[model samples]
Target: MMGLPANRLFCLVLLFLFVPAAVCGASVTRTLSTAEPGAGEVFTVSLSIDGIDLGGVVETLPTGYAFAGTDHPDDRVLVRGQKIGFAVMNDTAITYSVTAPASGSGDITGTWEDFLDETDGEVAVSHVAVDGIETAAESAGEKPAAQEAAPRFAVVAAAAALLLAGRGGRR
Candidate 1:
């Protein structure tokens, strides 16, 4: 009886040893061809991800950018709005072209979730001058120009109309 139990325990140990370990933890990186890309200029952006499963990567970029092409044409790519997801195995290297918007900058953001774990990170894209010769002046905590200017313009117009009405009444 003792020998039979020992033999079963030995088999269990060998079974555990032969099983492949699960891959844990994932890392993602984003790189741009030019440090500063101008409007309408298509630049190359590459994404290298490691330690992932067969279908566990999702990437998101801000508006005004589109996926021109990719290195791994075999890999499936799905895009919705600003987000892109991939169903791939293990590791992958993707090089794609991105056309900058008419104005401003775009940042890359993504999250990876698999049966193993979940991770997230962001990549800040650097914007050069429109001419591509100088860096644009950017203020810390300042919002995008297209988004910031609209509300302020409405307020200024309303104030100007009130002032003009007061002047007309005085006249």
Candidate 2:
């Protein structure tokens, strides 16, 4: 039989695993090709989707920004005013183009909905910087990708250590 401490430790490990998953069950990251675009310039916004398979994305563009085109199928694409929706069924990565206004700087917001799971969440916001403009992430010194991954790495390392300790006590 598992002792109280071991049982509690096991529960703690499960909590650590499930909490992050429930909070960030799935993720959608938006990236702009041209960091800073000239007035009337065309640029691309790519979405890197993870943990989603049968749903869609709805993006709301900044005022004056125009939806140009995309590689996603036409039947799955819908543009209404500044709001654009695309059915990303089975697509893990997709790219769409947009026309920067004569001059503007604003963030693009989006939401992802999983049809099968009936789950939806906000996507990470992306800034459209007109020439001479700086994004929020740029204004603040950006951290290296490795630095950003450190937290997840730490969590994984801690979990592995706990598992090893648990096994060491067994038998």
Candidate 3:
């Protein structure tokens, strides 16, 4: 028979054994609705899943921001006396409303943790960042009070340190 030799058959079996280990699931995609917001403003974030269910999901909002609202079924859908509800959208989109406080800049951060059937798989983790909101004071022709006084404070501190050092040297 035109077949693999015994040694080649062993190698083929080993290849099949390692194939599943190398295989991975599709990557999850996470996106934001906007890149920036004004301070103390509310922004909408849309989370989309391409190959997973829309349940058993928990999203963490950026620090100093609060979860304002959600666009999903509120009532718990029941099946056979058990609460069966869609926690996340599968092959669909979900939107969460959040409000950022009046601080921080450069990078705003958040996270999403997704699970399948409530207990069938490990949680999928996704992270997101937005350019943080800028304050009105920053936009106007004025620096933050601390920043404005930084140089003056540094000079005053240096003067005080020098005076203390001179007194100590005399002793």
Candidate 4:
């Protein structure tokens, strides 16, 4: 009857407001495969999220870190799947490959913003330290000097061979 309809409308309104808040309370987890990375070496950064919708999920990578790609286990739908028996809207597990430049300790941080659809309730920011490639001197050592000398030696030998060939032709 008319009372039943009114009750249903009130419940629907409550759900609409409260559900978004609950959904936006997302959790973010980040893991680094290795703390120390050599120059040009590809390493993995694993990111997992529970709660928010994939469509609304925005991952912000720190400066100097390139976004290799993203991975989602449940590709069939926008929402990944359920977690802990509760409906997890956007349950995504992503692996990002990053290359560290130079040799030093670099800080990499990721922010999962707008998780709960609430403007300010983003999940905790995760940070990882990447050890840059060892110093050039330590890595290459005397090899670079040798490599540089090799080309010069080749050039000199070629010049000497050309001069000898010309003298023989004249003789």
Candidate 5:
């Protein structure tokens, strides 16, 4: 490692640390189309799964909500004990819409399970809250705020430091 250049060593270190974790480990992310959903209104919740075959998924909707459908239709879809399940395979993302029932607040729980071996470590669970039911403000349908600009000072400083180091080494 000492014989390698600084940038090369950094790249090697990062590759060794992150590549296996990214390839072997499964990751799940959940997103809500609307944070505040009004009662009896339809909303979309999406789950993105990576590095897994994604054999099945279970979602527990809030008391006042019901699963409408998914982007990918499944014949074996079932609903029991306030939980919905569907069989899927090799899908990168599954998006489903749910209808909010009478005006109320509740939580949605979701879990992803693998069909094959558990040793592959392909499982994830997530929960999201549904609030602001029956609110006049929520009915207005407010969108999320835009992201702020990232700071450029660090990039410029790094470039300057690299230039100075190069010049000093050349001297």
Candidate 6:
């Protein structure tokens, strides 16, 4: 650390402190083909699941909606009423379709369980358009945003300044 230049030292510090957390944590996000869909219409939802080795997920659809189909293999998909479960192993993405019935609004909710890692959490919920109306949750359909990184950056900067301040004081 003493021999390294300032920029290089900062880069190395960031790489070491941040990379592990980013790599170990897993998350799921959903995207709707159309934010709004008509009654009796078939709509697609694309799920992006990353950082899993052996695990599964359960997607709970609003009542009156039917699971039309999915691109995932049938053997790995389980359908029980309005809920669908998918057994996943290292899969990064999946797409499924559902048919909206009547006119109503509801949240398309889900959860991710990482069996191998012994971790689980709610999937990022997103409001789907049913009968031309969006789901009620205003924050739906987006990833759980992490806290501001500016604070972390400031800490790193402060540490660097302290390291140089000692040398300047001696000079």
lDDT top scorer = 2
Residue-by-residue lDDT tens digits, candidate 2, 59-131: 9998778999999989999999999998877789989999998776777888888887666777766767789
- How do these models rank on lDDT, best leading? 2, 6, 5, 1, 4, 3
lDDT of 1 by residue, 72-113 (tens): 555477777777776656656666676766666545565554
- Whichever of 3 and 5 has more lDDT, that candidate is 5
Model 6, 1-171: lDDT tens digits are 344465456555665565445334677778888757788899899999987788998999977888999999999999999999999988999899999877766668888888876666667566665656654453375434543333344456556655654454342
C-alpha RMSD (angstroms) for model 3: 21.4
lDDT of 3 by residue, 1-171 (tens): 223344445444554454332223222344556656666677876655555554443454444566666676665222221112235556466666666566643232322334552222222332222355354444564432221212343345445544544454342
lDDT of 4 at 143: 25
lDDT of 3: 0.45
- Residue 159 of model 6 has an lDDT of 64
Q: Of the candidates shown, which would achieve the greatest TM-score relative to the real structure?
A: 2
Model 5 scores a TM of: 0.55
Between candidates 1 and 6, which one is better according to TM-score? 6
Q: Who is ahead in lDDT, 2 or 3?
A: 2
Q: Per-model C-alpha lDDT, please?
A: 0.55, 0.77, 0.45, 0.46, 0.59, 0.74
- Candidate 5: lDDT of 89? 76
Name the lDDT value of residue 68 in candidate 3. 64
TM-score of 6: 0.64
User: Least accurate stretch of 10 residues (summed lDDT) in model 3?
Assistant: 76-85
For model 1 the local lDDT of residue 125 reads 35
C-alpha RMSD for every candidate: 22.8, 6.8, 21.4, 28.6, 9.6, 6.8
In terms of lDDT, model 2 sits at 0.77
TM-score, one value per model = 0.54, 0.68, 0.46, 0.42, 0.55, 0.64
